[model samples]
Target: MTEIRHYKIGEDRFKISEDEVARRELKVTKVADDVIQIQEEIHGIIALVGATSTVNIKKDELKELIKIVREEFGWTDIC
Candidate 1:
């Protein structure tokens, strides 16, 4: 059986899944001043594809990102 879950740690959010074919993960973290980091990865026969991006964002940009993530993940609150 495959299982998928979403959770949060500190100022970060995560979604992880493990199944027969692959393991997939996504994470968002607020790092330092005006910076946020986003990462995604998939582990499988194709040699794990891991990618990461960092954005130096203003308060409004951060708020927009948070709102989008919260809506996508069905969360009422996030840090």
Candidate 2:
């Protein structure tokens, strides 16, 4: 599978995603699940779109998903 890459240019950040899903909601929402919704703003209609607001995941599955998200966006627990 192809992976998206993140980079820094001066004070700016950027991402190049070959994966279609990565470009849709994932960039704005991600695992934080904290994207503010403006009144009347419509959600994107894309692949993997779901009607439910939440999903039940196994502990191990969540852990692994988090690790991937962190690494994908160059996030770390340390400053």
On residues 1-79, what C-alpha lDDT tens digit does candidate 2 reach at each position?
A: 4343422111212243453222211211233333212111123324455675643344554464456445654456522
Error of 2 at 3 (Å): 9.0
RMSD of each: 12.2, 13.7
Candidate 1 residue-wise lDDT, 1-79, digit = tens: 4233333322322244353465444445544334445644445545433594443444654676687566654456577
Where in model 1 is the C-alpha error above 4 Å? 1-20, 48-79
Which clashing pairs does model 1 show? Answer: none
Cα distance off (Å), candidate 1, residue 37: 0.7
The local distance difference test score of each candidate is 0.48, 0.35
TM-score of 2: 0.31
In model 2, which runs have C-alpha deviations exceeding 4 angstroms?
1-52
lDDT of 2: 0.35
Clash pairs of candidate 2? Answer: none
